[model samples]
Target: MVQRIDVECKNESYPIFIGELPQKLEFEGSVLVVTNSKVAGIHLRTLLQCIYAKECFVCVLEDGEEYKNIQSVQRILETAFIHKLDRQSTMIAFGGGVVGDIVGFAAGIFMRGISFVQIPTTLLAQVDASIGGKTAINNKFGKNLIGLFHQPKAVYVNPFFLGTLSHREKSSGIAEIIKMAVMFDKDFFEWLSMQNLQGSSLLEAIMRAILIKKEVVVKDELERGVRMALNYGHTFGHVIEKETQYKQYLHGEAVSMGMIMANRLAVQLGYLSVDEEFRIQKILEKNDLPIYYKIPSMESFYQSLFLDKKNENHQIRFILPHNIGRFIPCTHLSKAEIMRTLEEFCDD
Candidate 1:
C-alpha cells in the first residue's frame, strides 16, 4: 500500500510517495537520472526501467562522501549539457542522501534552476535529507557549505530499497528517527525504546518521523524560526564529520554522537533530566547507534563550532532538547559553557 504526504511550500506543493517505485514515472520532457556507482550497480537498471520520459539519460558518480563536491556537481552538469537538457527537463535523484544532495544541487543550478525528483533509497535520505528541499555539497571548510534550498518536485521513498541496505546503514537511519522523537514526540520516543526496529515496526517509525518533519517544514520552509529546531543534533554532528573528514562515521552515526553531546549540554542547563538523557542514549544504543565520540581537542572542537552553517552573529546556535518532546534553539550560551561541555567528552 502506498501512503502519501504532501509538503506544502510557498511556491509549490509536492507529495512524498511512500511505497514501491512505480512501474512508470511519466515525464513530459527529457530526464536525467543521477546516482552513484554503488547504487547504480545495485538498483540503477530498476530505476531506469520505471522512467517513461521523452528521453532519459544517466550520470553515475563515484560512491563516497568525499566525492560530494563541486567536481561531482560539475560532472552532472556536464552530462546535462552533453545531453542538451533544457529547463523543461527533470532530473531524478536515484540514490541515498549523497546522490540526492548532489543531484538536487545540479538540477537547481542547471538553467538557473529546474525540476527534480528524489528517489531516496537509504533510510536516512527517505526520512530527513530527501524531504527538506535543502540541497548542498561539502567544501574544505565544512559539510553542506555550498548549496541552496532547492525543493524537489516530488519524493519517492521505496522501502523495498531498504532490503539492500547494510545493517550499518539501517542503524544510521534510525539515529535520525531517534532525533525526531527526542525533540518532538516523547510518546514516539517511548514507543521506539520498546521496538526491535525490524519490518513493520521500522516502517511505522519512518512514517512517524516523516510526519513530524512535514509539519515543521510546512511551517518554516526557509528555516527562519521554529524550523531551526530540526537541527537538533546536526551542529555537533557536522563538526564530527569534519574532524574525521567524513570517513570514519556515517552522517547519522555522527548525529547519534552529536545528540548525546547536545543532551549533555541540555542536562547541564537543567533543560533535560539525567533520566531523560539516559533514556535517549539507551534508545540509540538499542539500535546499535554510536553514542560517544572522543574529542581530540576541546579548544579546537569549540573553535570549529563556529564554522557550522547554523551559526550566525558570531554565535553558535544549539538545538537542545527542552526535556523530551520539545526543543529550544539556543544562541545565548557563553563560550565557556559550551567549552565545559566539550571537555566532558574528552578522553581521560
Candidate 2:
C-alpha cells in the first residue's frame, strides 16, 4: 500500500509518496538520474524500468559522505549541461542521503533551479533526508555550509530498497527515528522501545516518524520557530561529522552520539534527569548505535561549532531536550558556559 504526505509551503505544496517504486512514473520532461556506483549497480535498472522520459541520462558518483562536496555536485551539473537539460528537465536522486543532498542541490542551481525527485534507498534518507526540502553540500569548514531551500517535485520512498542496506546503515536510520520519538511523542518512544528494529514493525515506525516530520514541516516550513526543534541532535552531530572529516561515522551514528551528548548537556543544565539521560542512551545502545565519542580538542570542537549553520550573533544554538517529548533551543549560553560543557566531554 502507498502512503502519501503533503508538505504545504506558502509558494507550493508537494506530495511524498511512500511505498515501493511504481511500475510507471511521471517525469515532467527530460530526466537525469544521480546516484553512486554502488546504488546504481543494485537498483538502477529497476528504477529505469519505471521512468517514461523522452531522454534519460545517468550520472554515477563516487559513494561516501566525504564526497558530498562541490566537486560531486559539479559532476552532476556537467552531465546536465552535456545532455543540454533545461529548466524543465528533472533530476532524480537515487541513493542515500549524500546522493539525495547533492542531487537536490544540483537541481536547485542548474539553469537556476529545476525539478528533482527523491528516491531514497537508505533508511536514513527515507525518514529524514528525503522528506525535508533542505539540500546542501559540505565545506572544508563544516557540513552543509552551502545549500538552498529547494523543494523537490516529489519524493518516492521504496522501503524494499532497504533490503540491500548493511546492518550499519539500518541502525544509522533508526537513530533518526529515535530522535523524532524523543522530541515529539512519548508514546511513540515507548512503543519503539518495545519493538525489535529488525522485525516487521520497522516500516510502521518509519511511517510514523514521517508523519511527525510532516506536521512539523507543514507548521514551520522555513524553520523560523517550532521547526528549529527538529535539530534536536544535529547541533553536535554536524560537529562530529566535521571533526572526523566525514569518515569516522555515518551521519546517523554521529547523530546517535550527539543525542547522548545533548542529553548529558541538558542534564548539566538541570533540564533533564539522570534517569532520562540513561533511558535515551539505553534505547540507542539497544539499536546498536553509539552513545559516546572521544571528543577532539576543545579548540577543534569550538572551531567546528562556530561554523554551524544554526549559529547567529556569535552564539551557537543548542537544541536540548527538556523531557521525553519536548526540547528547548538555547542560544544564550555564555562562552565560558559553552567551554565548560565541552570540557566535560573532552578526551584527556
Candidate 3:
C-alpha cells in the first residue's frame, strides 16, 4: 500500500506519497523541473513523462551540498525570471536534499511564493528533507543559515531511485532512517534492527523513517516546540559538518555520528541506559559510521549553538533522547557541562 502522510501549515497542508513513483500525475499551469546534473542523467526521461503541464522546462544544477548556496539559488531565480514564471507557475524539486533545499527556497522567495512539488531521489531526501517545507542554503556563517519555511505542494517518494545509489550513499541514508526510528518509534527501531538493509527492505525502512518524521512535522510545522525533537542528532551533526568544512561527510553520515554522540551524552546525563547506548553505537558501527571526532575546543561550536536560529540566547537547546521513542527539548545544561561533554568526547 502507498502510505500518505499529511503535514499541516499555516495556510494549508501537503501530502507525502510513499511507494513507487507514478509515471504521470495530472496538474495545471506551467511546470519547471529543477534537478541536478547527476540526477537528471538518471531520471529525466521518467520525470518528463510524469509532469503534466501546458509548458515544461528543466533547470539542472551541479550536485553536492557545496553548490547549495546563494549562487545556485540565484541561478534558479534567473531561470524563473527568464521564463517569466508567474504565480500560477509550478516548480518541482527533482533530486536529493540539496536540490530540494535550493529549489524549495526558490519557490518561497520567487515572486513572493509559487507552487513547489518535491520529487525526492535520495533516501535522505525521501525520508526527511522532502517532507518538511524548510528550504535553505549554506553560507560562510553556517549550514542552512539562509532559508525559509515554504512547504511543497506535494512530495513523491519513489524507492525505484534507490537502485542508483552507491553502497556508501545507501549507508548514509540508513543513518537518517535509523534516526527517525530511534527518535519516534521504538517498535519501528526494533523492526529496522532486524532488516537485511539492501534492497526492498531498505526502501521499506526508508518509508517507515518518513512516517516517523511526518507525524512530528504535522504537529509543529513552524518548529515552535515539539517538532524540534526531529533534530535529535543534528546538534553535534551541524558542528561536525562545519569542522569538516562539509567535505568529509554526507549529511546523513554526519547525522549518524551526531546521534551516537547525543545518545552517549544522554547516558552520561543519567538518562540513557548503558545497554541502550551500546545498541545505538552498534547500529551506527554496523553501517560503518564513526561516532566521534576530536576538536581543538568547543569555542566555535559553542558560539554556533548560540547563533542557531532555534536557540533564544546564549543558552543552547538540544533535543535530548529520553528513550527510544521520546526526546525532550532541554536547555538546562550549563556551558560548563557542555565544555565537559566536549572534553569527554575528545578523551574518548
Candidate 4:
C-alpha cells in the first residue's frame, strides 16, 4: 500500500510517496541519478529499470558523511557540466541523506537551479532528510552550514530499501523517530515505548513521524520559528559529528547521544523529570543505540557553538523539551551553565 503526504510550502508544494516502488516510473526531460558507490552497486540497476527517460546517467560518489563536502558537490556539478544538463534536467538522489543532500544542492545551483527528486534509500532519509528542502553539504566549520532551501519536485520512500541497511543503520533511523515522539507527540512516545519496534509497528511509526514533521514544515518552511524545534538533538549532534570529523558515529548515533545530553540539560533546568530522562535513555539503549560520549574540553565545545547554523546574535539557541509532548525553542543558556551541564556527560 502507498501512503502520500503533501508538503505545502510558499515556493513549491510536493508529494512524499511512501510504500513500495511502483512497477514503472515515469519522468519528463533528461535524468541523472546521484548516488554513492555502495548504493549504486546494490540498487541502482533496480532503480534504473523502473524509470523511462529520453536521457539517463548515473554519478556515484564514495559513501559516508566524511565526503559530504565541496569536493563531492563539485564532482556532481562536473558531471552535469560534462553532460551539458540544462535547467529542465532532473537529478534523482538514489541513496541516503548525504547523497540526497549533495544531489539536491547540486540541482539547486546547476544552471541557477534545476529539478530534483528524492528516492531516499535509508530510513533516516525517508523520515526526515528527504522531505525537507533543506539541502546542504558539510563545511570544515560545521554540518549543513553550506547549502540551500531548494525543495524537491517529489520524494519517493520505499520501505524495501530498509532491508538493504545494516542493523546499525536501521537503529539510527529509529533515533529520528524517537526524536519526533519526544519533541511533539507524547502519545507517539508512549506508543513507541511499549512496542518491540518490529515489522508493521515500524512502518506505522515512520508514517507518524513523517506526519509530525510535515505539519511543522508546512507552517515554517524556512525555519523562521516553529521549525527550529526540529533541531532538538541536532544542536549537539552536529557538534559530535564535527568533533569526530564525521567518522566515529553515524548521524543517528550522534543524535541518540545528543538527545541523552539534552535530556540531562532539561533536567538541570527543571524542565524534564529525572525519571523521564532515564526512560528516554532506556528506550535508546533498548534500540541498541549509544547514550554516552567522551566529550572534548569546555573551551573546544564553546568554540564549536559559533559554527552552528541556528546561532543568532552570538547566542547559541537550543531546543529543549518541556515534557514528552512539547518543546522550548530558542533557549539561550549561558556558556558557564552549558559547561556545567556538559561536565556530567564526560566519560570520567
The lDDT values for all models are 0.92, 0.90, 0.82, 0.89
For model 2, what is the C-alpha lDDT against the true structure?
Answer: 0.90
lDDT of 4 by residue, 1-348 (tens): 898899998977999999888887777788999999999889998999998888998899999999999999899999999998887799999999999999999999998999999999999999999987999999888999999999999999998888889988989999999999999999999999999876899899989989998999999999988888888889888989999999999999999998988888888888999988988998999999998977867578668877888888888888898888898874578887888777887655
Badly placed stretches (over 4 Å) of model 1 are none
For candidate 3, write residues 178-241 as lDDT tens digits.
Answer: 7877777888878877777877777678767777787777788888988787787888887788
- Give per-residue lDDT, candidate 2, residue 83: 92
The per-residue C-alpha lDDT of model 1 at residue 336 equals 88
The TM-score of predicted model 2 comes to: 0.98
Candidate 3, position 66, lDDT: 79
In model 2, pairs of residues that clash are none
Worst 10 residues of 4 by lDDT: 339-348
In the order shown, the candidates' Cα RMSDs to the true structure are: 0.9, 1.1, 1.8, 1.0
**Candidate 2 local lDDT, 1-348, one digit each (tens):** 888888887788899988877888867689999999999999999999999989999999998999999999999999999999998899999999999999999999998999999999999999989876889999988899999888888999888999999989999999999999988998999999899976469989989988998898888877888878878888889999988999989999999988988888898888889998998899999999988887768877876787877788888899998889888888888778777777878767
lDDT of 1 by residue, 183-247 (tens): 88989998999999889999999999999999999999989887888888899999999999988
Evaluated at residue 144, the lDDT of candidate 3 is 83
Backbone clash total, candidate 3:
0
Candidate that would win on lDDT: 1
Residue 269 miss distance in model 2 (angstroms): 0.5
TM-score of each: 0.98, 0.98, 0.94, 0.98
lDDT of 1 at 345: 95
